[model samples]
Target chain A: MTDLLPSPPPATRRPAPPGALSIGWARVALELRLFVRDPGQLVFSFAYPVVMLVIFGSIFADREVAPGVDFRQYFLAGIAATGIMLTSFQAVGLAITEERDRGDLVRLQTLGTPPLAYGIGKAGQVVLTTAVQLTVLLVVAATVYDVPMPDDAGRWLTFAWVAVLGVLAGTVLGIAVSSFVGSARAAGTGIPAVAIVLQFFSGVFFVFSELPGWMQQLAAVFPLKWMTQGMRSVFLPDAAKAAEPAGSWEHGTTAAVLAAWVIIGVVVCARSFRWRRNAG
Target chain B: MTTTHGAPALPAAASGERPAVQVRGLVKRYGGRAVVDGVDLDVRRGEVFALLGPNGAGKTTTVEILAGLRRRDGGSLEVLGEDPAGADRRWRDRVGVVGQSTGAGDALTVRETVDHYARYHATPQDSAELLDAVGLEGTARTRVDRLSGGQRRRLEVALGVQGRPELLFLDEPTTGLDPAARRQFWTLIEGLRDRGTTVLLTTHYLDEAAHLADRVGVIAGGRLVEVAAPGALGAGLRQEATVRWTEDGAAREVVTREPSAVLRDLLAAAPTGEIPDLSVTRPGLEDVYLRLVSEGASR
Candidate 1:
């Protein structure tokens, strides 16, 4: 073989193996750099939620969700939840669909990127982007819009776990659905439409209690609704609980629902996922 | 079908010259039609074997099977001595693929894209040098989407060699490159060959096969029709050359194998000792290829 390849295989393909952690980090670093370079994706993932918050926050300014809290604070929490979905689910779904269509996943497979490393690396992108997007939303809400920060240590703990659960559910769902999108261009329409549909029913843009009972039941079945309620529990004062359909945070249900979605995503992805070239 | 005689197929692993790739009775079906029907092939290590076929001729399908990128319905394939069907990372790491450039991560810069691919190999070639060799150093920071078709093909070549893999599969690697860039790419493949990398390539260009392949395989109707050295392909069909010249205020032409003897005879017979605008030509790979494909189509 050396006659065909002047260098020995041991020198090229067989050095001390890159441990799983290193390969994962390399993929994450590259994915993140690519995400940052695309201005359209940057604006959508980082700033779209803030832009939505500002527009709706002002329009609902005079309205009040509870005695002390106004629409701005109410929207602050819901929009933060929406930011997680946008950055994790929508962003990851679109990117993966496009990657699958473009043969990116296939190329990586051929290059021998370990499947675990690739999976972890993709999840890393979702986690990183959602973290940054949430930061941008919370910063703008607390600073520019006068939305109050969480004052209790336990509240921030809830926020952390909720964010993690929310992003996990969202990104896992994204990976599962990406296999169904037939082409890259089709993703532009499919992902945003699903997001919008979920947003409307999930009570991100409106009060969950005000929705019809059937819609509320439908919304309850989805992670976005639970994520929104979970974020509200972290940010809203106790009085705002009056506007929640359950009259309390329902923290147990939120965790259960999000965890269920995660399992469902994993199972569905295992069964139906098609990555790589079936190109004839 | 396109097996050309050069040296005998190099002795197998027992001879200290392993076959880089071997296929026996390979089969692949789509909706019950055989796309690749019972293909048997052998590519000796360090050899440049070009697979040539018209569209839908199973060339890509066979190459894909060899590269471990596709599954076969039946039959056996061994690449680097391991069946690609169950081949693992150790097998993949030694195989470099320059696939048809549907292109993934087009948003990544040329440098970034090549660099990411490099990490997959244990000891890749210098990313910077690879880019420069492909004439893409100027576009290193340019996103892949910004590259022209030719430039992207160059990037494909750059990444193909980045791994310094023992076996490289190049599928239509020069499809969109300009003549000069195609030549440049040929030079790069030659460099890889000289470095001892066994190459299995597929191309639509007969000239590319003529220029780069040690042996060329032609496929048609899901089976290999012939594999031969380029000069040997059309030899038996029409052995005569065409000699054309202007004489006596008119054009004249003759078909003969001995063009030089005819030229000598014509020069002696000419009153002015000249045959104007004279040329001697023979059939080439293209002629053989078109005949083979058309013959296959009719059959």
Candidate 2:
């Protein structure tokens, strides 16, 4: 059993680095710069939430609903939820889908960009956006409305976990939706359309308790309701729990519901991720 | 350049032991129809091989399969000594793929895009230098959205070669480029050849193939009908010369083997010793390509 065959030549290029940090971070830096180039987009995504808070504050000015609490204080938690969903789900979904339709994702595929790096970069963007988004909502609620800022360490700790979980829910849901929304035109209209509808159920503009039974059930199935409840746990006073749909912030249910969504979104995104438009 | 009729075109030949690419009985099916029906090809190291075909002749499909961007139904294919289907980031770093119409990162400046892409490679060419090489240095600060179609294609070329890949897959690289830019692209391709990079380009421009490719593969009906050096492709069926002349104020056509002798006889018969409105023609690579494709299609 003697065989003789010529071996191939050695490859000319050097071995690639272990991870995609160098490449992915470069993409992030480039996208960050691109984000700044369009002043309108920056203002719309980051500043619009504050504008929304002002409108809500003006409409609900100082009613003294819960001893010292007004309608604006009760409304603060819901608005914070809306801001999270807006940036993490709506903004990320639209941006990623646009990139996919325009073949930017495909281009990244050919350039040896590790698949996860794209996800990480996109998630990083959403995380960064949600930070600014939440900051503005908190600022307006505290400054204009004279809402109490939590000095208690336990309350602040609760706020931190809730925000992190809420952001995860939003970012993952955005990625999953990008798969379901195929073309640029559909993505452009579909994402915001879904957001507007979600707002009605999630109680961003009105009290979640006031919504009909069917609407409450529908809203409970989504992360936005849980996000709103979690924010209520952090911002609203103890007695304000009377207004919640579940008769309290339902902190345990808030953690379970958002965590469930995180798992579902990760599963859907795994199955639906398209490397190319024509790819089955 | 005086290679034998059967010899592969040596566009700054490489002395490497491995061929840049090899495929055997490659097949791809779309629903029921086999778009790439059993193709076999070999491109030597450092050779500029052009796959010339019509729109649906599966040139792009075959390139996609070789780039590992698509899966084949059945085939044994290799690029840079590895199966493209199983290629990793390391494998991708050693290659490049440019599509016919690519759109991405339109909001970034030319310099930013180039610099960003170069990060994927271990030791990529300098972004400024790559832009300069592709004639995009002047537009380095220009937004990609503002670049002309031709200019954007140049930027793609710059990005494609930034890795200094061992093999480059260009699917209609010059489609949107102007004539001057096309000439510049050819020069850039030649520079890649000097660096021992093997290029597999699919193009509709046969003249582009003729000018740049060391060898041309005319693919039609999902198969390669002919593969040869551009000069040798139509040498056989060429009934030699295509003679045209103005006879009694009307254009006339004839085919013959001995064009020089025919012209001399025409001059001898003419009283003016000048054959008015006469021209001699010979079959080119394009003629061979058309005949090969047409004949294949008819079959």
Best by lDDT: 1
What is candidate 2's lDDT per residue for A80-131, written digit by digit as tens? 8888888788877888787887778778777767866777777676677678
DockQ for each candidate? 0.29, 0.23
User: In candidate 1 chain B, what residue range of length 10 has the lowest lDDT sum?
Assistant: B1-10
> What i-RMS does each candidate reach, in Å?
4.8, 10.8
Write one digit per residue (lDDT tens) for candidate 2, span B131-241. Answer: 767777799999899998888887777777777677889999988678997987788788777667788999978899899999998888789888888877766766677
Q: Which stretches of candidate 2 lie over 4 Å from their true place?
A: A1-13, A62-67, B1-16, B240-281
RMSD, model 1, all Cα superposed? 5.7
- Runs of candidate 1 with Cα error greater than 4 angstroms are A1-13, A16-20, A277-280, B1-16, B234-283
Clashes found in each candidate (C-alpha, N, C closer than 3 A):
16, 0
> Where is model 2 chain B poorest over a 10-residue stretch in terms of lDDT?
B1-10
What is the C-alpha lDDT profile of model 1 across B123-166, one tens digit per residue? 77777777776678799999888998888887877777677788
TM for every model, in the order presented, reads 0.87, 0.88
